[model samples]
Target chain A: MSAKSVQMVLYPDTHLDQAAETIHRLRQHGIDDRDISVISGVPYSDKILGRPMSWTRIGLIGLAGAVVGFAIATSLNFGTPYLYPIRVGGQPFFPIPTSIVVTFELTMLGLLISTFLGVFIETITPSYGPKGYSPKVSDGHIGVLFSCPTEKMDEVKKGLEDLKPEWVKNPEAKL
Target chain B: MAAETKTLSATHSASQEGEDLRQEHLMHDPKPREEMNGMVMEAMQTTSKKYWIALAIFGLGVLILLFGFWGNQIITGMGVTGKRRPVFWALYITTFVFWIGISHAGTFVSAILRVFKAEFRRPFTRAAELMTTFGLAAGALFPLIHLGRVWTFYWMIPYPNARWLWPNFRSPLVWDFLAITTYLLSSTIYLYLPLIPDLAMARDRSTGWRHSIYKLLALNWRGTEAEWHRLRKAINIFAFAIIPVMFSVHTIVSWDFAVSQTVGWHSTIFGPYFIIGAILSGVSAVVMILFIIQSTMKNMKYFIRLEVFDSLGKLVLIFSMAWAYFFFNEYLLHWYGGYQAVRDLLTFHAQGPTAWVWYTMLICNVAIPWLTLWNRKIRRTPLAMFIITTLVNVGMFAERYTIIPLTLGEQRFPFDWGAYSPRLTDISIVIGTFCLFIFLYLLASRLIPLIPVWEVQEGQMAHSTRKLGKGKVTSVAELE
Candidate 1:
């Protein structure tokens, strides 16, 4: 039977150099990249940390939202005029120049609203339940959260401790 | 040996200069993130007796001037104010445009600066963004206030209803509704996205009701690599997308006048002219607010340094020039075209009973900025900047006054021509909205983190002084 997984937390200072070295050491251990996460006060680029780029569908979702907005705008500008035709002078039922304003406004509205929702969706936010988190991470401390087999926890902890983290223990472990 | 001694002295001087530069710029001055977080939290928590007194005054202004007059107007009707046939759109619309112009300050400072990678925008981006949200809130009220039957304002909404009558999309009024709604939502979201991490920072530190509210608002942010990555990507997209939206909003506002049959109002230049005016006024308001924040808030002196005012002053000067160019272009074209109605209006504006408004616009927007902002010493002085920026807004208000009521007063036919002036209701409601804006900002200052501490920390991390020749220059690394 496979050994049950246990999450370990390694707290480093705000500097990227130390965080990079710690991440490198974790990779040298049998830990896969997917099992590791870095929590930080400030955002550090993936290249600096030597970590693979984190994938996000926010852009795609925003584009899809723009498309939806465009459709709604079109329906309002072109489609609705047909429902209740209020002819003004000899102007067309749907003037292209005038319609552009509504179209552009709605399209951007979609892009922005959807992009905002994308953050919530991608992050699975508003999650109030318990998880592996540390308050110190927000105080400019870089926290490396990774899971390893329960049997290998001590060995990984020993490797991480050599780097002199502020603390290293089970994330859920009570202070 | 003499040459070696001279070289050592030169290097020492250059190093000293570099240290001075570091002290001057916020980006070069590094502070521990924990300390920054604490400073921001302390600023939010700490409120003096003066703050309460000021809040009470603004709150009373909102209740009495805004709500009280607005209620009186609603009960009495539109006849309480000056809204004659030719001069239908007056001070209410002028104030609306002014507030909308004010809203541009946030987008200009936050999104535009972010896109250009201007490092000086780091400390007070949140302050400007809050202005955008609240400014829009204030501006959005004018449309309803202008309405005779304010309850029927929902007729502008593009929706299927019992009447089955859809709003005419061709109308600029409808366009205003759509554009303002979009800009408000987008800017609010933009504001919230960046604020999440800060909310998390606040949440981690606080307890009781403050902790609960912060936790809810923070959306359970863990500051994980994935959350930050997505947030950064989203913010980048917003920064680019929001600029054009900002332009479109003021442009549509200009269209509300431009599309009209009124002689002075109908001009293609109005779009860009209005936009430039909005930016000028917006950026100036930002400086004024920054001055207030720096003076009032705790530990803000470190974040909102002289360098920010200096940089923003330069922008205000450039925008002032741009506004002057557009102002001159519009007037010159109308003069050169020699249209009778346009000629009469232009002549009246310069030499009419209310020509002081026109002169005030020129003196405040053009003369004051051109005269003072050129000097580096004046630009760096916060008190001077606050005074100059305040005058600029006064000038912008005068400009809007010229465009709306003054222009409307000048009819093609002499028989139809009549003067318009704001009644007690008009003056009171306008004051109310101003009070409401300051009131919202005051409440927000105590509730939220006014500075983006992480962005400041990030900028500090990226900045370092590097020696080029005899002198060391400030160098910044492109982190993202």
Candidate 2:
């Protein structure tokens, strides 16, 4: 597969709204929102960008983890006593009060661990591969990394430049 | 504390360099995002000689007192220290509960403020979160140190041994262990999850070894919209879900004592009493640390402002009142019951040789907060808040001393009762742990961005001022 980053434009502080307009321009020019990316130092939600909300599997993963954690908690809490059934003052084999602690801990444990892993899995983090990233983005520049056709590259650059971005860079990625 | 800051700003305040007077607030006067990033990075990179000297002292203490003394105790049996008769719990347990109390503030301050969307929480969230992880580490250590046979500490695990006897499901120690482990893991993960974006930011601007380290930690984040969505969702889940877990951690820690048959420790009110007391101490510790950081660290004055100290002081005041209520509830119950053992314990706590310490504890924890924290000037004053919170911590330590050692030493049952004067080694070990906590925190500040610059930037994005009738007021747009 071959992909070329059409243009990278830097928008300063409040002029970040111009980046939104450029994103709108990209969409109007038949660029799929998925094909075009908005990169910035800070996180901006879909509302700010006027883009569709991105779906995430993190919540579902957390819910699944809670169920699994509860199951483990139940097994440990209920089944552990009988394994070593030496009577200690004739207490109940398994008490609900003690079991509640284990279950609660496990449930939260599962939620957090899964939510953490969900980030790595869903976001495909730790990706050291060649990405169309710019250093200026971290310096508070609002950058838009968009993909356009090989032939239409000039037109895309012209569109972004019209928004008066500080500078636009062309990128080449080969796989 | 406020006076020190007044002095510090006159002397130690980082070069404002033509910064607007209004820009003293982190929110109202926003710096260029790039400039803010530079400020944070510079703070991490630049370590003063005073910082290194403090670090060297803490580092030496950690190497010798924490590890060396602990190693010596591990070789010699548990007999070298103060554990004897009824007071077998002694300073170890006291310090354990103390560290655990300190842990609660970080989660309470960070998670509660985040859930409520209190904008002032922006700058100090990372600092408080760091305290949570490090404080738990310190708290977990006291238990291991308390176990004279430290190597076999894994015996507390629920798995069956060769005799096939598993850990008793009914033990509060097991519950405390579980809660601590769960909380440490949960809070550590919680701390790291949001730190990812900031780490990525650090990675973007660095080269050489620093770049490689940040690159690996950042998980190659590029701040894509999908990535941000998932990150935000996960952080939100942690924020809401972790609150109950935070409460459970401290409550279960209290159960370790409340479940016991000891005269003063066996109170049903211990759970809420411990929670309230924990918050009082925890919030105070946060203030103490924030005061130090704001005063000493480079460029921190711009982030940690008077409003932060003011809000935190308000929280300390509320927790102090709640603590008083819970303490009074326990006191009245024992007084009304007229049990001889309970009566003896109370008398010893109040009228014994340590009576002055007890009265000072009351004055510091209850009377002083009631009298002073209500004043806005005092609350806003960094120095005043520091003194008040420091006194509250002293009172809290005194409270622990009264509960654990004194109550255990002077018991109703004569056979199991004995005085527990801590050996110098025991005192050093506790001091070592304190130094280790500070050392770990000092090291963390250098590595991680203490302020979440991205979050601050996002906050700056959401926050703006608008004209309302005749005056301008700050308004924040809900970004999510």
Candidate 3:
């Protein structure tokens, strides 16, 4: 991204195989996967178009939240009943089954809410900044954006031209 | 050997052998992405006179009923409703449960179907998500209406008090408060997460107020590879995670009654029974809304088709039977126990003043669906589905009524037994909530693009027809 990228192509068709071929040509022109960024209206996994898989920590964060929630729910359930200690003729002081219900709810709440926030954190949303962006991507065009040395710009253009994209343009910064 | 092989092959049935899968399913029959965006935008922008007239009517109802009734309730305290003696929780609770049941359909349909890669779910998922949010909104109002001091709603928030009293974890009501809050948050976030891409799409081709709004909501989403990857992962988490939250919310709500020492309410089956019934009503409500949107809104015909109705109808039937089985399970257990008071409660539900509602429940929820939904023709017709689904909702409402007020009216002491009926304020609040629900939905239809265009396009990309031995069949490529 730092080498000054241009959005190389905007393909009108949603042919998965052809999209893969376009990426293959970029690689043949010596573009690193890190230098290439795929953009489209739909969330298509990279592996589908022969790109490297990207990892996300949302699930792990969810698991961590579940643990934290369980701990809090446990403390509240175990401590609160005894603290209040209202005498119900024969009911036990700390009802574990009842506590389990509260614990379960909190655990799920923690997991779900954390994963939701994880999306915003991972995507750095509400950014509203200038970076690489094209509105045609939302109209279902797959914009292949990549950066290269100034000398290789012509070679990159030639590679993209062979892919027969509907349009090509320099991507305005959307950071 | 060739002749024998041909004869064996002929014995195999290819149901979609000649039918065009594209014509049958929305996924297979996709227009271009641009065309889809145009159609969706048109549906949002093309509200008719009737739409406004309905909105105005509902809006008036909201003003009169909400403020008027709730104000009366606030002034008069809890006695305004039929919550007398043993029948302490009646109409509001019943309706609350009914709304919760309705909310289940959205999460069940959207999250579960996404997990299974059901392509037909692409278009109507937003509609169902809206139902979940609005239904919960309606459901949340009841506890407020039920509160003795309506203004003191914050006491449930677990903030440290002057007396240092906090919300009790042991109380099932607290569990419900926690569960409902969690569910509302999760479902709203769930609704908004997938909506980002569509908001971005809307942002692209709009001007004026719409453009400004979409731009804000779209979160500058240019659909970068990292962003899409993160979005997919997050949605996957939501899909799996929200299902359990959905189940917990209703199951915890069920516990509000189930854990009580009351006769019929103290059953182990209530958790699952309530969940099944919720999904049933939710699915029916979804079908009804889909039918309305398809018939009334512009270009909805492209997104919502008979196939959607048929698939939904099948779910309604399956859950209807599930509800019946659970009803029987709960019934047989009580009947076999032969407890005199429990028997009296059952008799009251079946033969008392409100016995007709119970009978109607049986007919609407069980009998009608069992009889008609099995027929593909009845299931496929949008009008037929609309009617049957409307009945299903009626039956489910009656089912909740039978559980709450009818049983509440019954007493183990016999002398304390009294019949419960809603007063005018109670009735008004219920009507107001119903109007409010529809009003929110009607307004939302204009604000948000109901169709998930990106998901639909992605589904279209995944779907193609491949030639088989004797015919072409629908084949879905796992694009993920």
Candidate 4:
């Protein structure tokens, strides 16, 4: 199946609400949900934009990191005697009470570092090439973009105009 | 205190008569967003001859005092710092505790208030968090410089080596390593996460290399609903986790002293004592920074108003009371037990050569704040609050100094007891750290929007005036 792609831009702040209305209008016209995109300066939630929640895989990754950290700590605490043993203060080589601190610290370190990595991975941050962007978004604006069949472009633009956007224009998404 | 209140109210009324200034000075005098933006931009762009002069002085201080002086100390060994027998932990440790205490305010303001949804906390949380990061950076240095054998510092880590000498995890020193590092990471992340949106704003507004830098930092954020949800969720987890982490970090730091077998250091109450001391010093540090930001930064005067100072003063007052309570508990318990060594230590702290420091700590930490903060007028006055808060910080510094070295100076064995006088190198390094903190803060203020705009707009949305019967009162709707 060959599908044609068409694009348009709306002034982010004034046109976002109308663009959202147009997306609803298009969904009724049988456009798939995946064809629509909304961008803004501040984080606009999925519920507000009528989209599904994006899941973060931070929890699984963080747990994995913690386990690895715990393993290293455990090995260090228990394996030290076989590696090189020395008695101190007439106590045994491995002290249970003292080992807890090392394990706890490493586990925490793992969880935190993984969480930091998770934010970047989940967000796919630092993408700097030209996509669909508008300056008004920074000034408390929101923009919505949707793809449609080339023949239906005028109809969709008309539908968007009826909802009273600030302005709408076709723009290329370079990269 | 009541008498002070009357005197202050009289002064307020007199000032009102002179200026005829209304409560509507900044809030009701609302300006356009564009104008406000220009004000902020201009503030950042505009530099005075005096600013350059001051920067030069601080810059020179940093060069000579921090690097040059620290190099001298490192070269001369720890001996140059006057850290002789029985006074092993001297000026460096005192500054460590002081800097660490200064750091707690940032997390307290940003995380604690963030947890409770305090509307007034909006504008200054970032400013306070910057304090936390910079203060922690400065605070971390004291320990490293104190180490003397700084190159072998990695031995503090618990990593297994060929020699297989396990790090003593039971020691509070090890805990300090873990806890402080955790705190630095957590606070830095917490500071950066909320800053992403603002960075995006700067990216949009800026040009050239600045724009490129901001674009990279802003990431590809488009404020999608899912993105907002994830960001909020991450922030929520951090906010909750960081508070306990903040508490534990200082408690563990307190353990550095409390775990010791020495007379004054062995108190069980040191944990709470240190926590209160941290809050006390931290809040004061916040007030000082807020005052500077408001007076010096352009549109900052609008954001950081009398209400903010009023709220901060109230915190200062409450923490002062808490500090007094902790001090009384610790002092009474020691005095009541009549242990000779503890009693002697207490006596020497009060009447020995360093007695002046004890009194100064009391005056700055307790008396001055207790006397002034009772008055709403004084609390509302930025200059008064700044002076009093500065005093509180000085007093807190003295408290730490007395706790560490002065107490260490008069231990059970008189044969080992000795006085500590900070050498020139010790003094310079301390001055350098202070300069470094202020220098970093200055740089940050220029580069970043010190006021969190989203948080401010959120607060403004929450706040409205409602009239009832004969009075109009401002009320806030809780918004997360």
Q: Considering every candidate listed, which one attains the maximal DockQ?
A: 1
Off by over 4 Å in 2: A1-6, A87-89, A125-131, A170-175, B1-24
Predicted candidate 4 versus true structure: per-residue lDDT over B305-403, tens digit per residue: 898899999999999999999999999999999899999989998998789999999999999999999999999999999999999999999999999
Write one digit per residue (lDDT tens) for candidate 4, span A1-175.
Answer: 5455646455534344565676688777666766666666545456655665556666666677678878877886787555666667878677887677667766766776666677778777533222465555556556666667877777766766666665445444321
DockQ of each: 0.69, 0.65, 0.63, 0.35
Stretches of model 4 off by over 4 angstroms after superposition = A1-23, A44-51, A63-67, A76-82, A89-94, A125-131, A168-175, B1-39, B160-162, B462-480
lDDT of 3 by residue, B1-480 (tens): 999987776654343343456567888777888889999999999878899999999999988997688888788787777678878888889999999999998899999999998777999999999999999999999998888688888888755468666677778888889899989988998999999999988888899999999988887788877788778888888899899889898899999999988977999999999999999999999999999899989999989988999999999999999999999999999988989989888988899988999999999999999999999999999999999999999999999999988887786887888888788888999999999999999999999999989888888888887878766767888878
Q: What lDDT would candidate 1 get against the real structure?
A: 0.90
TM-score evaluated only on chain B, model 1: 0.98
| Best of the two (1, 2) by DockQ | 1
Better of 2 and 4 by lDDT: 2
Chain A superposition TM-score per model: 0.86, 0.84, 0.85, 0.78
Runs in model 1 deviating more than 4 A are A4-14, A125-131, A173-175, B1-15
Scored by lDDT, model 4 comes in at: 0.78
How do the residues A1-175 of candidate 2 rate in per-residue lDDT, one tens digit apiece? 5464555666875787898998898888888877777777777878888887778889999999999999988988887766766665857666788789989998989988998888878766443222466666777887777767677777877877767887555443210
Rank list by lDDT: 1, 3, 2, 4
> Across residues A28-93, which tens digit of lDDT does each residue of candidate 1 receive?
987788777787888888998889988789999999999999999999988998887778797776
Mind giving the per-residue lDDT tens digits that candidate 1 earns over B1-480?
999999998888877786788779988878888999999999999999999999999999999999999999899988899888789999999999999999999999999999989899999899999999999999999999998799999899988678788888889999999999999999999999999999999999998999999999997788877889899999999999999999999999999999988988899999999999999999999999999999999999989999999999999999999999999999999999989999999999999999999999999999999999999999999999999999999999999999999998897998878899789999999999999999999999999999998899889989988878755778899877
Task: Supply the TM-score for candidate 1.
Answer: 0.97
